[model samples]
Target: AQELLTKISEKCFKKCIAKPSSSLDSSEQKCIAMCMDRYMDSWNLVSKAYSSRIQ
Candidate 1:
């Protein structure tokens, strides 16, 4: 799970953060964080639903 999280973080951060500045800007970082969260949340929900359907 930790490794998956790191991979997701990297992909989302790369897409969202076009400019690699010294520090993550507040607003951009916030957006990236939220986007990563929602992405993972939806992924979990989807897996849950899929497993239920399969079972």
Candidate 2:
């Protein structure tokens, strides 16, 4: 569980963080939030598609 969480965090950070700033700016924060939502949506879609194919 812990290992899986770490990997998810790493992937999300890479997708959301284009540059290393001292702190997350307002726009960056918003982008991160949206990116997270989109990532989850994509993941769910992919999982659903795979399951349907298997069935």
lDDT by residue for model 2 over 1-55, one digit each (tens)? 5764575677778977888899988887777778767767877899999999999
Q: Cα deviation of 11 in candidate 1 (Å)?
A: 2.6
Tens digits of per-residue lDDT, candidate 1, 1-55, equal 8987887788788778888888888888788888888878888999999999999
Off by over 4 Å in 1: none
Cα misplacement distance, residue 50 of candidate 1 (Å): 1.7
Positional deviation of residue 27's Cα in model 1 after best superposition, in angstroms:
1.3
Candidate 1: RMSD to truth: 1.8
The alpha-carbon root-mean-square deviation between model 2 and the true structure, to one decimal in Å, is 2.1
